[model samples]
Target chain A: MIENEFYSQQNVGPYEYYQVGEFELEEGGVIPQLQLAYRTYGTLNEQKTNAILVPTWFSGTSKNYESYIGPGRALDENEYFIIVVNQIGNGVSTSPHNSGSPIAMEAFPHIRIGDDVRAQYVLVTEKFGITELALVVGGSMGAQQTYEWAVRYPDMVKRAAPIAGTAKNTVHDFLFTQTLIDAITSDPGFKGGRYTSHTEVADGLGRHADIWAVMGLSTEFYQQELWRLFGVESVEQFTQGFLRPLFQSLDPNSLLTMAWKWQRGDVSRHTDGDLAAALNRITAKVFVMPIDEDMFFPVRDCAREQALIPNSELKVIESRLGHFGLFGAEDSYFEQVDCYLRELLASP
Target chain B: MIENEFYSQQNVGPYEYYQVGEFELEEGGVIPQLQLAYRTYGTLNEQKTNAILVPTWFSGTSKNYESYIGPGRALDENEYFIIVVNQIGNGVSTSPHNSGSPIAMEAFPHIRIGDDVRAQYVLVTEKFGITELALVVGGSMGAQQTYEWAVRYPDMVKRAAPIAGTAKNTVHDFLFTQTLIDAITSDPGFKGGRYTSHTEVADGLGRHADIWAVMGLSTEFYQQELWRLFGVESVEQFTQGFLRPLFQSLDPNSLLTMAWKWQRGDVSRHTDGDLAAALNRITAKVFVMPIDEDMFFPVRDCAREQALIPNSELKVIESRLGHFGLFGAEDSYFEQVDCYLRELLASP
Candidate 1:
C-alpha cells in the first residue's frame, strides 16, 4: 500500500490495478511480481471488442487523458470502455519509490517503452480477456507506448493514434531526455537514488519543470499571455505555483526511471535499426497526429515516421500551444481532434 | 589579482582593462570602482575614427570575439582598432567572482545590457579618447550589447551588426534565461551564492550547458551528425567533453550575473517600451543579421525587430548551422557576413 500522497491512487483516482506476475523487461531486467495501475471509464460491451486503450504521458496520470472522455468527446467513454493504463515508473504504477526493498530505488532496473507495452498487452489479453482493441491512443510518452503497441502487437490493435511522439527517439529527443535525468541525479541530495526524502532534490525537480516551461510549450503560449487563461496573474506565478511545484512534489527516482525509458524508446531496436521495417510491422489503421508547435517532436519529425507506416494517415494539430496542445488547451483543437478520432474509431 | 583559473585572464586572454570609476547602473546600483576588461587588436588611427567595439556574449570572453578577427576577416583588426569589451559579469571583469566583499556573490547588484553599454561608452570615450566607432558587432548576448550601443549612443556607433540576438529579449528568451538561472541556484550546494568551491555546482553548470546543446544550435546539428565537424565521435562526447566542462569550470554567481543582464536586455525599456522609437534613435548603419535556423532568435522574430529599425538592413544568414553559424561554422555564412561588413564599412 503506497502511503505517499504524491503517488497514491486516491489523490488522482478512478484508478485500479492488474497483476501481471514476474514481468521481464526488454533490457533483460526483471521485476519479480508487478502490478499495473489503470483507470477505466464506461463499461466493456458484451463483444469486449469496443474497449479502447489510452496510455499516460511522462509525469501525466490517468486524469490527464480524461479531458476528452465525455458523452460527445473523442474518447467518449459512454460509447466505449476506455482504459487509461499508467506506464511503469509513473508512481501510480509499480515505481522505484513504492516497490519492495529488492526492487526499489536504485534496485529498480531500467524500464523501457517496450516493457510497458508488453505489460499492458498481458493485462488486456489475460485480465480483461480482450483479444482486439477498438483503438489505442496517447500523446507524448503515451504516444511512444502507442507506437510500441502498434509495432509489437499489430494483430491485437486494429487502430492506433500516436500523437506528438515519434517512432524512434531522435538525437535531439535523446539529448533533451538526458538533460532532465542529469538535472535530477546531479543533486547532491539524490544519493544515487537512495535519498531519505524525495523533496531533498526539490530544486532539481523545479529545474526540470523549468525546462518544460521553455520547450514543452510553444513560444506563443507565453507571447499570448496564456498563463492568464490558466488563472495566473503572471508567468512567474504559473511557473512557481503550477509547473515547479507539480514536479518538485513527485519522487525524483520515479522521474529518472521514466526519463531512462523515454531515452531508449526505439521501435526499431528489435528490427536491427531498420526503422522502416519496424514501422511496416504495423497492421493497425494508424492516425499519426503531432502538434505543429511542439519543440520536442516537431511535425516534420513525426511526419517522416508517419510516412513510413504503410497504413497510416498524418493529422497535424495546428495550435500555438505546442506539445501541450494535446492537453486540450484550446476548444478548437479539441473539436478537430474529436472529429478525427470519431472517424478513426468508426472506420472498418 | 584574481587567481581563480576560471575567472583569470591567463586561461582565456590577450586581455587588458580600462578602469571606469564609480560606474552607476541603470537599475540604480553603483559599483564603487568598476574595471572593464578588454582586448585590443590593431591600432587606434591618428584620426581616432577607425575604432570598433565588440562586446562578449554570455559566458564568453574577449578571446571568443577573436574567432572572426584577423587580417582579412569580417572583423579584420588590421583595418580597425577592434576593442573586445568583456561584459561586466563575465569572470575576467568586475564580476561576482572577482568583485571585492560586501558586493560579492549574491550581493552583486543586478546588471542590464544598457549598463554594459554605458561602461563600454566610458572605455571608448574617456579612456581611449575615441570619438567614433568604425563598427560594433557581436552575436547572442554580445548582439544585445551591440543593439544597446547603437540605440544609447547612436553618433558614437557609425555601423553595427547584431547577429543571432534581438533588440529586446523575447518572452521565450526570458523564459529560457530564467530556466538557466533557476537550474544553477536550485542546487542545494549553491548555499544561496556562498559556495566554497565552484565545482560544487558543477552538475547545475553541466545541465545549463546541456540546455544550450538543444536551443543554442539547429536541429541539423544532430540530424546530420555535424558534431563530427568539431572532431567528436558523438553528440554526447561534444556535450560531455566540451560544453559541460566549459560551463562547469566557470563561477556560478558570475554566470548568474550575466544571465540576469541577458534577461533584462531591452533597448525599449529606456524608450518607455516603444521598441520602434528606440530603434529609430539609432543613426548607425545597422545590419540586423539573424541565422535562418536559430531556435532562440528565429528569422521571423528577428525580421520583425529589424523592420522597426529605420536605418537598418536585415541580412538573413542562410545556413543549417543555426545560431552557431555566427561563430563561423559555415564558410558560406562568413563570406556573406564579410561581404556585407566590407560594403557597410567602405561606404563613404
Candidate 2:
C-alpha cells in the first residue's frame, strides 16, 4: 500500500474502476439492475491462492481502509492480494449521495448483504478468475457483509473475520439506525428524500454523528468526554458543537440510504426467516471479534453467533472505545486478530 | 361484589350519575377543579381504618379495577374499605377523552410520577376526608403512581404494592412509548395536536395496540399466539386482526396525553434526579412484586428500588404472563399478594 500520503489527494493513485451488474432496490417490488464500484490490491500467486476480500464500512470509502495495508499490517499488500469493494450506498458506488436526479425518491434498488456478496462474486470471477477467497475481513456494516459472505458462499471463503457485527439484527440496532434516518428525513427541506437543500444536510449529519458517538460508548464515557470533545458539557452543546458540525459535511439523503442498508444487513432474509439456519450454513472458519463495552454490538452477540456457526471462535476485546475499538483503539484487538488469522484464517 | 353479575354489565356501572368533581388534568396545564368519580365496597368505617386506595390503570376506569375488589379477594371489602380513584387521563377523570376543549399546547404542565402522586393526594384529602390509607394497590401505570405515593406522600399510604412497574424508564420503554406518540402526532388529522379531526382516532389506536403487544412480550409468545389470536400465523396477521381493532376503540388525544404522563413519570424528577434518594423517601412499606417472565419490566429494575427502600420486600412471582402476570393471572399471584397485604400491610 502507498503511504498516508495516499489519503492526501496530492499523491493518491487514481481509483481503478470495474462495474458489476445493477441490483433492484426495495419498494414497489422491483429488482432493478444496480451497479457496483470497487478496487483491489496485491498479487495472485501461480496457484491463485492469495486472494483476501475486504469490504467497506458504513459511509466508509475504499481509501479509508487502505491504511491497514503495506508490508507488515493485517492485510499486508505484499503477502496477500486484498480486494476492497465499495458498498452500494457509499458515494463512490451507486448511492443517493452522488447519484443524479433520483437523489431521494429515485427508486434505488433495495440492496442487502446477499446483493452485495453476489455483486462482489461477479467481480471476483469475471475480473480475476477467482472462484474462492483466502478470507473475508471487514468491520461494522462491511463486517456484516463479510459475515454474510461466509454464510452465503461458505465454500468460496475459506475463513472469515467479522468485527463488531451481529448474526441477527437486534431491535436496539434498528432503533439507533432509525434515529439517524429521522434526523435526515424529518427536516422540512428533505422533501420526501429528493432533497438537494444544504440546509437539512447539517441537521441530518449532526444527528448522525451524535448518535454514533453516544451509541459507541458507555453512559459514563459519554458523560465524561462529551464536554472535553466539544467544549460543552450538556447534550445540547455537544449536539451542536461537535455532532451537527461533523455531519453537516455530509449529504442528508446519502446518510439515510447508508443507514437503511446497515439496518437491513441480516442474512436470514435468504434463509426463509431462520436466523439459526442462515448461520448454521456457514462452513468457512470464523473468528468473531466483538467489543466488550459496546452497547450496540457486544461480545454477548458474538457468542450467540458462535453457537450456530460450525467452526467458529470468539475474541472479546475489552475496551471503552466500543465499536471503534474494533478499528484501532485497542492494541490487544489487533494482536488478537493477528494471532487468530495466523492460527485459523491463514491456510496451510 | 355484587356477585359475578357486576362484570357482565349492560353498560358497566352507574358511571353516568357518579360524580365527585372535575379531573383537573395535569397536562395541558388545565387548572379546572375536578371531582373523583368512584364506586366502593365493604365499609369506610367510622374511623376510616379500612380505606384502601385503588388507582386506575392507564385507560381503566373505576369499573374495570372494581372487578378486582369485592368481599373475598385480597382487598376484601369485608375486611377493608375500597375506593377506586379514576386517574387523570382516564375519560371518567376529566381527560381529553371527556374534556370540553383542548388543554392548550405548551401551556400544559409536565406531569411526572410526583405530579400523579399530588393529584391522588388531592382526591383522597379533599374528597374522601381520609387522613390515612390502609394500603394502596395498582398495576402497570397505576403501579407507577402507587410507587410515587409510597415515597412522595409516605404518611398517606401505610402499605403499597407496585406490581409490574419500574422506578425509572428504560430505553426499551422510552422507544415503545415514543412509537405511540409518533403514531398519534404523525396522523395528518393530528394537525399539530390541535384536534383537527376524529378520523385519525381509529388508525392511531390501531397502531398503539400494535406497539404495545410487540414490546410487551418475548419472541416466543408472539410466535405461539399469532394464529390463535389473529387467525393468521405471523406478525402481520396478529396486528391486523387483534391490535388494529383494539386500538381503534381508543381516542387518539387520550392516548397522547397518557403517554406523555407516563414518560414524565421519572422518579428522578421527583428527587432532583436522585433515583436512590427518591426510593429512600418512602416511609410506607412497599412490596415490590415483579413477574419473572415480564419481558419488558424485568425483576432487575426493582433491584435498585429494593436496595433503596428500607421497608421494602421483593416478592418474586414466577409466571409466564409477562408484565401483566403480576396483576394476578393465577391463584398463586393472588395468594402471594393477599398474604403480603394481610400480614405486612396491616403493620404500623
Candidate 3:
C-alpha cells in the first residue's frame, strides 16, 4: 500500500489506526495491504463496556460523524468510548483514492457492506481486545454496516441502530444508486476511471449531486424553502454551494466504489439469498430507524425488513430533511436519536 | 432558414405546415420565420365545430399523439377533426436544431408554453380557418399548452383535458427539471451547445434519461417489472432499449428549449401570478386529469390546481406507471381518458 499520511487516521483525527494486513473482500477480491482509519472519542474503561462502534456512510469520513459524538449527544463521548471507523472506499481508508496501483480506480475490486463489517470485527476483536459492543450505530450506508455487524457477528454486537437504511437494498433504491453511478461514469471527463483529479470529472460530480436534489430530500424540503436555512436563496445557489461542491470534492472512483457496495448491500448474500434467515441470525437488539420522508429508503421498506429481524424494533424518525436528516438538519431528529439510543442502552 | 423537408412537415407527415412570420417570444426575442408542424388524423367537418386540437409534449411529435386520436379513442377521429400540432422546438417543428443563424443552439431564445400556445392559435385560426375547437387535450408538457389555451383563448375552446400535468410546475418538479438540464449542460462534450452530433453527448443524454428513471415513474413501476411491458427484463435493458435512445434521438438544444418552457409552465404568468384567476378565466369545460402515481405532478398537486378552475372536473387515473401512465401503459388509463373526454364533450 502507498500509505499516504494525509489519509491516515492520525492526520484526520483525534484518531487511531488498525492494520488488517491482507484483507479479503466479500465479493472475492483482496487488498494486499489494508489499513482502516478510525477515530476514538473519550476513553475505554477497564471492562471495555462503554464502547460504541460508529461506521462511516457512503462518501463520508470519520470526521463527519464526529458531530454525533461529544458531551451530551446520542453517542456521548463523555460516557461512551465512541469509535468512528471510516468505510473502505471513503478516501481516508484503503480506498481507490489512496490505494496502491494494483487496487486503484479501475482496478479497485468490488466491496460490500459485509466486508466493512468484517474489517470492523477485526478491529474490535484483535486490535482493541474488545469482544462486545455497547452499540453498533450508523445511518445510510453506515446503517448498512451496522446491520452487517449485528447479523454477521450477533453476540459481539449487544445492540445496533441502523438509521435511514435497509438490511437489503430495495430495487427502487438500487435503480436510484445505479442512476447516480451512471451520472458520474457517463461524464466523458471520467475517462473510464483514469482521470487525473476530481476536477476532471467535476461536471459528472455536479450531475451526480443533481440526482441527490431529487432523491435525497422531500418535496416539502424545497417547497418550504429549506435551502434558505443553508443560507442560499435559489436552487442554483444551493446546488453551487452545497450539492455540487460536496460531490466534486470527492474522488469519482471512490464514489463508484461505495456506490457499488451500496447497490449490492444484502446481508442475505451470506445467508444463501434468504433475507429473513440472515436477519434471523442477528441476536443483538436492533433499533431500525427510518426517516419518514426519505424517498431512497422509505420507512415502508425499513418496516418490511424490521419485521423479518427477530429482535428488532422499528423507530420512525419524522423529518422533512429526508435521508439527510441524519446530518442533524432538525433539532427534533437529534432528540429522537438521543431518545432511541438512551432507550436501547437502558433496556435489559 | 434551412427548410430541409426532413425537418419540414413534407417528410415527417401525415403532417402539415403553417408559417407564422416574425414571431415574438414571451421572453423578448423573435423568430424571423416560425413554422408549426401538425398532423390531422380525421377530416375537418364542414362546420369546423368538431375540430379538436392536440398539442405534443416535450420531445414528442405529432405522430406520437396518433395513438390517442383514432376511431374509438379519446379524440375519436371518426367524430372529431383531431389536429395534433407538434410543439415548437420538438425538432420537426421550427426549433434550435433546424433553425438558421442567431437562433440555433446556445443562441436559441427562450420559448415558453405561452409562445407555443400562441403559435398553435395562428395555425388554428389562419391555416385551418377553424372558428372553434370542440376540445384542446394533451398530457405532460402538452397539458401545459392545454392550460394555456383554455386560459388565453377561453371562448375558442369548448372543452379542455390537461392530463398527467399541472397548470403550474411545482417547486419539486422544477428542481427535477433543472437537474435534467444540468445533466445535459454539464457534459463536457456539449461544449457550450456547439456539439457536432447527438452522439457527442450520448453520455449526457444517458444521464438525463437516468434522472427520468427516478422521477418519471413510481416504485411500483420498477417493483412489478412494468419495464417488462416495454419488452425488457432488467433496468439496464430498459435504460438502453427505451429511455436513452428516446432522448438521444432528439436534439439536446431542442430538449433544453422544451425543458425551459416546461419549467416556467405557469398560466399564472399570463394572469398576474394569481393561479386561481388564471384557471377561472377558462370558459371551456375542463377535465383536470392526473396520473395516480405521478411523482412529477402528484394527484394532490393536481387536485389543488383543479379546485381553482370553475368549470373543471378532477379525474384521477389510477396506475403504477407514474407520469408515464399518460402514455397508455395500461388499457384502464386509456379507458379512463376515453370516458373523461366523452363526458366533457357531451356536457353543455
lDDT of 3 by residue, A236-346 (tens): 788778988878877888899999999989889878999999999998889999999888888878998999988889999998888887777667888898999899987
Better of 1 and 2 by lDDT: 1
lDDT of 3 at B226: 91
At residue A20, candidate 2 shows an lDDT of: 68
Task: Estimate the TM-score for candidate 3.
Answer: 0.91
Tens digits of lDDT, candidate 2, A1-348: 101221233322334556664444433333333556666777887777789888887756677566556677767778888888877666556665444444334444455666677778888888889988888988888779888898878888898888778766665466456655665564446667655454544544554565555455543344235344335666556556655565665555555667777877888876998988888899888888777766567576677877788888886666655675644634565776666666665553
Across A1-348, the per-residue lDDT of candidate 1 in tens digits comes to 234687665677769888898988878879988899998888999889889999999988887877878887878878899889999999888998888867888889889999999999998989889999999999889999999999999899999999889889998888888878877887778889888788788877877888888888877788788877667898889888988998988888889999998888899987999999999999999999998888889888898899999888999888788888877868878887888798898778
Whole-model lDDT for model 3 versus the true structure?
A: 0.85
With a 3 Å backbone cut-off (N, CA, C), the pairs that clash in candidate 1 are none
Q: Scored by CA lDDT, what does every candidate get?
A: 0.86, 0.64, 0.85
Candidate 1 chain A has its poorest 10 consecutive residues by lDDT at: A1-10
Candidate No. with top lDDT: 1
Angstrom error of the Cα, residue A171, model 3: value is: 3.2
Who is ahead in DockQ, 2 or 3? Answer: 3
Model 1 residue B291 CA deviation in Å? 2.1
Output the worst ten-in-a-row residue range by lDDT, candidate 3 chain A.
A1-10
Interface RMSD of each: 1.6, 7.2, 1.8
* Among all candidates shown, the one with the greatest TM-score: 1
